[model samples]
Target: MKLFKSNEWQRVKKSKAMVIALAVIALIPSLYAVIFLSSLWDTYGHVSNLPVAVVNQDQTATVNGKTENLGQNLTTSLVNGQDWKFTQVSEKTARSGLKSGKYYMTVTIPSDFTKSSGTLLGKSPKTPTIDIQQNGGRSFFAEKITDAAAEKLKNKVSQSLQKVYLENLLKGTKTSQDGFTKAAKGVSQLGTALGKVQTGAGQLQTGTMTLQTGATTLSNGLLQYTGAMGKLTNGSANLVTGNTQLAASLQKIGTGISQGQAANAANISKLNAGFDKVNQGLQQLSQMQVTIDQSQLNSSAASVSSGLSSVDQNVTAVLADPTVQEKMKTDPAFAQQVSDLKSNLTATEKSSQDLKTSSAALNTAVMQQISGLKTQLTTLSTQAITLNNSAKTAIQQLNDSLSQVANVLATQAAPGATNLAQGATTLTNGLGQLNGQSQTLNGGATALSTGTSQLVAAENQLTMALQATQNGSDQLAQSLANGAVKLSVVHTGTKNVQALTNPVKNKSTSLSTIANNGTGMAPYMMSVGLFVGMISFSTAFDFITLGKKPKSGMHWWAEKQTVMATVWSAQAVIMTGLLVLVDSMAPKHILMTFVVALVTAFAFNQFVTMVIVALGKMGSALLLVFMVLQLSASAGTYPIELSNSFFQVIHPFMPMTYSVDAFRQVISIGGLAINDLLVLLALGLVSMVLTWLMYHRKLQADTVLFPKTAEK
Candidate 1:
C-alpha cells in the first residue's frame, strides 16, 4: 500500500491531465449528493402557512323569522385556524386583496345556501355554492394552499350539515312525541264532540221529519181553507138571493098588512109579513154559526123588513105571537109548553143572526186575499215565460258566434296546408340535390384519383426514360471516343506523308488539346484526393485514444483535452465552411469565428461531458436535448430575442447558440472582428472554471459513485 501510494502520487504530480481527471471524478458525486438530499424542509418550505381570504356575504340566519340577513351557518360557525379563516370584507375588497397579493386567493360563500343541508339518509350534505378566485396562476404554492383550504371548508360544511341534520332528526323525536300527545287529546275531544254531534244530528233529523210532516199537513189545511173560502163565497151568493127574496117579501107583506089594518081586510097579510121578517132575521142569525163557509154575511144579504129595532124584535118574537100567547094563557099546561117553545126558538134565531155577521166580515177578508194571490201568481208565470224566451235567444246568438269562429278556422287552414306542401317539396328537392351533389363529388374524387395515378405513372416513366437516355448517351460517348482514337491513328498515318504541309500545325494543335484535357482531369483527381484525406482524418480521430494508457489519468486527461481542443477548432472551421459551402461563402472574420467557436465548444463540452460523465455511454439521451433545444430551436438560426422563452433559456449554453450569433457578426462586419466576443468568452470561461473545480473536488473521493456499490 505504501509503495502504491508513492507511485500513484508520483504519477499524479508528474501529469497535469491525471490530476485534473482525478480531481473532477472525485468531486462529481459529492455535488450530486449535496444537491439531491440536503434538506427535507427546503423541498417543502415554499408551501407552509400560505394565506387566503374568505369572505362570507351571507349573515347568520335568525332562529326567528326576522333579522338583517340569512347568514352562511358554516361561515358563522367556522373555527379560525381549524376549519377556515374568515376575513370580513365586501366582495370588491376581497378581490382587490387577492389581486394585490395581500392574499393568495379569496373564497366567498354565496346566498341561497340552505340547500346544502338537504341530503339522503345519514349521508353528509354538500357544501353551499362558493366562489374561490385565485389571483395568480395555479402553479404557486399559494394557490395550492388555497385549494387545500377550500377542500377543507367543503368538508367542514358537510360535517356541519351532518350535525344539523342529526339535530333536526333528534328534534323530530320530541316533535313526534308532542304531536302524539296532541293527537291523542284531539282524538278524545273528537270522540266526545262526535257523540254529542250525533245526538244533535239525530234530533235535528227527527225534528226535520216532524217539520216536514207538519208542513204537509199545513199545506193541506191551507188548500182546504182556500176551498172552504170558495164554498163560503158560493153559499153567500145563494144566501144573498134568499135573504133578498125574504126582504122583498117582508117589505111587500108589511105594506100589505098596513093596508089591511087600515081597511081591516085580512090577518093573513100581517102573518105573511111577520113570517118573512122571521125568516130574514133567522138568515141573519145563521151567519154567526161556525159552518165551513162563513162568507155569507148577515148585513150583506139580510131581509130586515125595513123596520126599526122593535120590528126586528117583533120578527124575532114571531114564534111568540099573540095567538100562541093567548092559547098558552087559556090553558096552563098548553101555555107552559108554548112559552118553552118560544124561548128555544128565540135563542136559536139570535145565535144564527150573530154567526151571519161574523161570516160577512170573514168572507170580505178571504175574497180580498184570494184576489191578491191570483195577481201575484199570474205575474210570476208571465215573468217565467219571458225568461225562457230570453234564454233561448242568448243561446242562439252564442251558437252563431261559435259557428262563425269555426268557419274562420276552417277557411284559414288552407294556407297551412299549402305551406306544408311547399315545405315537403322543398325538403324533397333538397334531399335530391344533396344526393346528386354527393354522386358528383364521388365521381370527381374518383377522376382526381385516376388523374393522380396517371400523373405518378407518367413521372415514373419519364424518370426511367431519362435514366436510359443518360446510359445510352454514355455508351455513345464511349463509342465516339473509340472512333476518335481510330480516326486519330488513321489521320496520323495519312498526315505522315503530308508532314511537309501540316506536321508543324498538327504538333502545336495536339499539344494544346493535351493541355486542355489535362486541366479538366486534374480537377477531378484533386477532388478524389481531398475526399480521401477527409476519410483518413476521420480514421485518425477514431483510434487516437488507443495510443494513451487507460491506467494513467494524465494520458486520459491529455487525450480528452486534446480531443476537446481539436473538436472546437474543427467545429469552428466546419461551421464557417458550412456557411461558405451552403451559402455564398460570405466574407468572415476568422478571429471572431475562432473565438465564438471556442466559447461555444467549451460551453457545449462542459454540458455534454457533464451529461456523459453523469450517465456514461448511456448519455445518448443528451442528443435529444441537443436536437430539440439547438437545431429545431431558433437559438441556432435566429436571435434568441426573436425566439420563444424555452429557446432563449438554453441559447447561452448551446454551441450553435453562440456560433450562430458570431456567424452573423462576422458576416455583417465583413472581417474576423467582434467586441461581443468578451461576453461569450466570459460565459464559457466561467463555466469551464466551475467544471474544473468540480472535477478537482471529485478527485478527492475514494471511488466512483455510480454502478460501484461495494467498497472493496
Candidate 2:
C-alpha cells in the first residue's frame, strides 16, 4: 500500500499530460462497455397459430347476409377464443381463395350437401362430405391449424345430422312412407294376372308346334308315296310294249320259214323232170348206136379189128424195144388212120360205159341228194309248222297275259282310287280339327317368346323402383339425426389461433424485473470503454509521457494492481449482485440474473488490462486519442453508429459486444450464455501476458521509452 502510494502518487503529481490523458483514456473502454450490455430486449418464448377459410354449399335456407350463414355460424361457434381464425365464403370461391396465399387452408361443403350430410347414419347412403384440404403437408403447424378447423366443421356437420334425425324420429309420419312396400304389393297383384296369361300362352304355343310338326311329317310321306307310284306305272307300260314287239318278231320268222319250204318243194319237182329227160337221152343214144352199128357194121368192125391187131402188134414191138416202149411212138401213122375209126367205136363204147357208170353214180348221188334234200325239206316244213305253232302259242299267251294284267290293273286301281278318296276325306276332317285348335292357340298369345321376356323385364323394373323409394325415405330420416349431434357437442373449446405481437424493450428501469436487470448490464459496455481508456492512461503515465522514473505515480500504479484489484473486484461483485437484491425478480431463473452481472464485470476488467498493456509509456497521449475517438463511439449509452469509421473499426473486437450478448441471454431468456464462456476465459488469460511484457519494458526506461511523454 505504501509502495503504491509513494510510486503512483509521486509519478501522477509530476506528469500533467500523463495525468490528463490517463483520466480520458481510462473513461473510453469503460463507458463503451456500459452502453453495450444495455440493448437486447425481446425474443423469448411465444408460439402461434394460422387463419382458415370455411365455405358452405347448402342452399336450403334463404338469407340476405354477406357471409354464407351456415359456414359462418359454424366457424364462429367452434373456433372462438382458440388459437385460430375462421372466416366464411361461398363454395365456388373457397378453393381458389385458399390457394391465394392469404390463408393457410380451406374447407368446402358440396352441393346436394344435405343428401351428402345425411349419409353419416343412413342405410346404403353414399354421403355428401365436406372437403378440408391444405397446401402444406399434414405434419406442418399450418396443417395442424387446418385440421383443428376441419375437426370443428366435422363436429358441426355431425351435430346437424343428429338433430335432423331426432326431429324426424320424434315426429313420425302417419302413413308408411316406405316406397318398396307399396311397390311390392302392386307387383304381387300384377304378377298374379300375368301368371294366368303366361300359362295360357304356353299351352297355345305347344298345340301350334304339334300341329306344324304333324303337317310336315304327313306332307313328306305323301311325296314319297307319289314318287313310288310314278316309277311303278312306268315299269307296267314298258312291259306291255315289250310283249307286243315279241309277237311281231315271231310272225315275221314264221313267214320266212313258209316261203323256204315252198321253194324246196319246187326244186324237188324240177329234179324229177330232169331225171325223165336223162332217161330219154339214154334211149336215143342206144338207138343211135344201133343205127350206126348197122351202117358201118362190117367195114368199121373190120378196120377196128385190124387196127386193134396192128396196135396190139406195135404195142408188142414197142414193148419189146427198150426205146419205144409206148404204143403211140411206133403206130403214130397207123394210129392216125385208125384213129377216126377207132374213135367212133371208142366214143360209142365210152358213151355206153360212161352212161352206165354215170347212171349208177348218178343214181347213187341222186338218191343221196334226194334223201338229204327231202330231209332238209322235211326239216323246213317242220320249222314252218313250229314257227306257226310258236306264233299262235305266243299270241295266246300274250292275250292271256294282257287279260290278267288288265284285271290286275282294274283291281289295284279301284282300291287305290277308293283309298285316295277316303284319305282326302279324312285329311279334310283332320285339317278342320287342326284349324279349330290353331284358332284357340292364336286367340291369346298376342306375341310369343318375346312377350314373356318383356313381362319378366317389367317385373325386374318394378323391384328396382321399390328399392329406390325405401332408400330415399331412410336417408331423409337419417339426415335429421346427424344435425342434432353437431349442435350439442360443438359449444365447448376456445379458439386456438392468434396474431404475432410487437417486440419488447430490455432495460434496468423496465416494468419487468428480468427485463430491467437485463438493462442494468448495459453499463458494462461503457465500463469496457473506460477499461480501454484506463489502460492507455496507466501505460502513458508510467511509460511514454512520464519524465521521471523512480518516483512516478504511473510507475507505482503499474506494479501494484492488488490495490486496483481490491477496488475493481469490490465494485464488480457489488454491481453484479445489486439488481438481484433490489427487485421482485421476474419468474425467470436466478442463475441467469447472476450470470449477466458476472459476465459484464469480467468483460470490463479484461478490456482495461488489455489496453493498459498495449499502450505502454506513450499510452497517455494515445489514451487521449482513444477516449475522444473510441469512447464516443463505444455505444455504451447511445449507439456508436454516429462515431467515425476508425471507432467503428475496433468496436466489434472490443469484449463488450460478446459480454452484452451473454448478458442478454441471461436476462431475456432465463439462462447463461454458456456458449460464450470460453471467449471470456480466453480474454482473461491473454490480458496477463500483455501486462507482463508491456508493463515490465515500460518500467525499465520510462523516460527514454516514451520520449514524447518525457517532452510533455
Candidate maximizing TM-score: 2
- RMSD of candidates 1 onward, in order: 55.2, 54.2
Once superposed on the true structure, which residue ranges of model 1 sit more than 4 Å away at CA? 1-48, 59-79, 82-93, 100-102, 110-128, 135-145, 192-712
Candidate 2 local lDDT, 254-339, one digit each (tens): 34334533543443344334333323322232232101122222332333234333333332322232221232355585345335
Give the TM-score of each candidate: 0.27, 0.30
lDDT (Cα, 0-100) at 46 in candidate 1: 36
Candidate 1 local lDDT, 184-276, one digit each (tens): 333233234334433533443343343234323323433332343343234334433444353334334334334433442233233233334
TM-score of 1: 0.27
Error of 1 at 304 (Å): 82
